[model samples]
Target: MNVPVHVLKGAGGKAAEQMAAMGIETVKDLLFYFPFRYEDFSIRRLEEVQHEERVTLQGTVHSLPELRFFGKKKSRLTVRVLVDGFLVQAIFFNQPFLKRQIELGQHLIFHGKFDKHRLMIQGAIVKNAQSDGAFEPVYPLKGDVKLVSLRKWISQAYKDYGDEIEELLPESLLESYKLIPRAEACYFLHFPQDMAKFKQAKRRMVYEELLMFQLKMQYFRKQTRESTDGKEKSWPAEKVNSFVEALPFPLTAAQSRVLEEILKDLNSPYRMNRLLQGDVGSGKTVIAAIALYAAVNAGYQGALMVPTEILAEQHSASLKELFAGYPVTIGHLSGSSKVKERRETLEKLASGEIDIIIGTHALIQEGVDFHQLGLVITDEQHRFGVAQRRVLREKGIRPDVLFMTATPIPRTLAITAFGDMDVSTIDEMPKGRKPVETYWAKPDTLPRVLKFIDKQVSMGHQAYVICPLIEESDKLDVQNAIDLHRQIQEVLPHLHTGLMHGRLHSDEKEEVMKEFAENKVQILVSTTVVEVGVNVPNATAMVIYDANRFGLSQLHQLRGRVGRGSDQAYCILLADPKSDSGKERMAIMTETNDGFELSQRDLELRGPGDFFGVKQSGLPQMKVADIVEDFRTLEVARQDAAKLVASEAFWKSEIYAPLRQALEEEGVFRKERID
Candidate 1:
């Protein structure tokens, strides 16, 4: 059944190369090249067609096709067709060759959008024969692959190799899930008789995809839990209490609840794989600090890995302040650290002198060793891949792992993407944290906004002016951080302005952030690099230029930078959104400050692609399943996959053999075993 694309009809030379460019080299790949959308081309009478709708009509040509040239390079073909006693004009733009195919008194089926103003059909297709009342699939195409050529090739492929494809799901699952046969679903997905059948076919395919993904995730979780044994550490309640009581502020109920959950996991025998998700300024660091304190009290070392040097430095400084009176020693490691500093830090870490080490990816470098490392915590977990996390955890013997993300994700998507790890959310902000007031303004309000920023600066508070781009771009019309920094300095004249962006060197970024944090810089103009972990409690206002260019979650994170302190914070969005989506994003930012709610709205508005990079989630790319649209199907599949993983007899059955082989081919089991 693994036939090459070249063997298919008309797939030769250039055609074959085009197919290969789309990753369709085999018959299996062809089958999985699902359509992005479908169009209905069933024949309809002229009277049945609606204005501004796309439809197919069978009619006889009443007038010969005439070509008219608007200019030297542009020409259009027009003809009149008679259908059910109604005459309608058909227009084809830039297709002069269509004049020969359409003739007077010839019967043809036309498909296109109906324009009521011109009383014409802007025809995309004009076939000599009638359609068979079936939906036409619109596929994602590559270079030189015409729709007609692809359609013919696909038809020939199905005729020659459709029967060779074996069913991937078991008969019991098909019956229980009310799913059609795999071969039948494939056929119906490409050419459905009606919308109902298409829906059923899509459902079957989506269910299969989700089921496989969930099975793999569950299998990895089960394998890891059973194969790896963790250190049985005692949770000294007194020590944890003392650490919490020493905090300058009290913990919210949500934080307390999540901390209790983490404590339970640390005391358990199985190595912990947990995800700590919270909104900005939700106090996740305090929870992590308490866990590290418990690990150190249990005679072990802990390491916290972050994504950037400034974040690592920030965490180290904050932890040092939090553990000021404690006996625990903290070490910092980053790419910018001097050689002597790194060497001393490593030596201390290996000798058990450093109880807790905080650093960036530099902590995972070769020769960096840990003495009695019992816990590993990664901040902004999405920034690191599975291999990086594994490398850090391998520094110790099955150390408990905790991954934290301030980027709030929709609950359903979190379940689908991070199904292998347990989840804990700090839903409530700490006491004295004020909700930031948000507003949306146009570009004309810049002068007023600059004046407001100056006012905040004069009151001994800092402000962040965010730009969408780091530098000037000929392609984009938005302001850049570097350019905006100069403009702010020129306009404000008296305020101390600083620039921060991702392109700066690590040490340079650290210095800029340090200045901003110490109140030396009253107005900081930066890019989204400051969205993650730059904490300045004295910052009171934020002005985001072209705010519509940012996603809702990103806008929320930027807004979070200002509201960390006791003063009332304000977020001003300066954007003139032309699209509905852009306007909706700006309005949502102005409406609420809840990250979780905004995350759900963001998924609904921008889809999974913009919300979370699918490639970075470590899940297989799905052909039919959408983590946002098909969340119910995902939940069902997750439950079924868990049940299958729990039942030993199912693994040995012949019905499960094919699925096991498929999973193995995808390297799911290999990655599990290696990790």
Candidate 2:
């Protein structure tokens, strides 16, 4: 089964090359390459055939085949077949040699779209008449790989190496799940007798794929908990309560609960790998601050890494104010840090003078070093890659990690993407916070929308005018940042407006954001760069142009920019979407303010591939199972895998040898350690 695909008959040279291009290198690979769909060619009687229906029928030739040439290398072959005492014309295009295969009084079969009114079958596939017809497997093709050759080669592989494909699951699991043998499922996937059998085979394959994936995830989680040792920090509860009481605002109930969970992990013996997720303005940073306080109190340094420089600066200022009276010393590092300041921060961090360090990716550079790191917190966790987080962790002795993300991930995605980490969600907002009111307006309503912004600004509030593109493009009719900035200044000439986008230098963006925060710029026209970092509590109005061009999660994040203050906030969406899906997205944005709901809807609309970039997320590419559609199966597999991996005897038992072998073959060990 492991032999090269070229060993199969008629699968050498060009065929082998094409198969390799499709990721089928060996006979086993060819067998496991499932078809995307099946063409229903089941034989049906003449009386049962309907007009324009695709079907197969057994018949005998009633007339000599005629070949007619139309143009260069183009010809038509026609024959009359007698089917159950009725004559029907069968036509084959571009197959002139088929005239010799069909003759008068010859028994044959035809599979094609039947035209009952004309008693003709067009584009017919002629075969020697058989008692029964089969459902043909339709595979995804590459290059000039012919479907017939693929079918023949697959059939040959099945005949020659069928016995080598053994059952992977044990009898107990098979009986409990009502699953067929591995070999039978593989065979039926390519040559199913009926739709029922095909569905059964598909269920088995999907279950196996999900089960294996979940088992490996469970195994890695077990390894992380049992193999690695973590610091058990014992901070003073009274001191923590005092620090919390000194804060300007009280912690929400959700934030309190999540903080309790994090504290428990900090005190545990194993290194903690937890994910802290919440909606916008949910006070996640406050919880991180308290956790860092505990780490610092435990006599170990802490590090907070964010995506952009603006966020790092915002967090630095806020955390400083939050810990103003405390004895903890905090330092900031970034790509644009001055030489003297960076050198001083590095010296302080190395000399144990700084208790907590905060920065962007610069915190992971070689020049930076921690005195005695204990806790690692990553803000906007998805923006950084797995390798970056690992490098920061390697600075300490298996420090406990907490990942913070504003993007609320769906449950299915959370399990698959962050399967190895314990998840804590801050679902409640701080008391007295108002939900941003969302509205959809057409381009023709710009005057009224601008008037609304002007009113908000008159009340000592600020506004953000978000555009999809940084500059004008001939291919797109949407508004650009620069042009929109100019237009806004022209329309509201008295209002002070500024421009910000990704193309601007980092320092420029930082200055623009600082001005916006300080209310110097009444209206800031910018691109999506402000989607994550900027925190302007005084900004109460957000106007988004071409809102339909963004996803639900993005629209929700953009809306979060405002509504931070006590005053009411408004988000005006300017879009006239032509497609039904785009219109639905706009409507959904206006219907709910819950980030989790929006994320689920986004998953449904865009699927897992687009909702989360699977390539960037470091998730396995599943060939059979979909995390969204097959969530129930995934749940079952997760539970079963967790139970099986927990049993001490299961790991050493020979009965599970095949399962272990499959895991090894998948290179599960080589996969990056989950955080």
CA lDDT, every prediction?
A: 0.87, 0.90
In angstroms, the error of model 1 at 659 is: 3.0
lDDT of 1 by residue, 51-109 (tens): 88898888889988889999887888888888788788888888898887777788888
TM-score, candidate 1, is 0.90
Off by over 4 Å in 1: 3-21, 43-91, 98-110, 113-123, 127-129, 143-146, 579-581, 672-675
lDDT string for model 2 (166-238, tens) is 7888888899999988899899999998989998898999999999989888988887777648988988899
lDDT of 2 at 199: 86
Supply the global lDDT for candidate 2.
Answer: 0.90
Per-model TM-score versus the true fold: 0.90, 0.87
User: What ranges in model 2 sit over 4 Å off?
Assistant: 40-134, 670-675
**Model 2, residue pairs in steric clash:** none
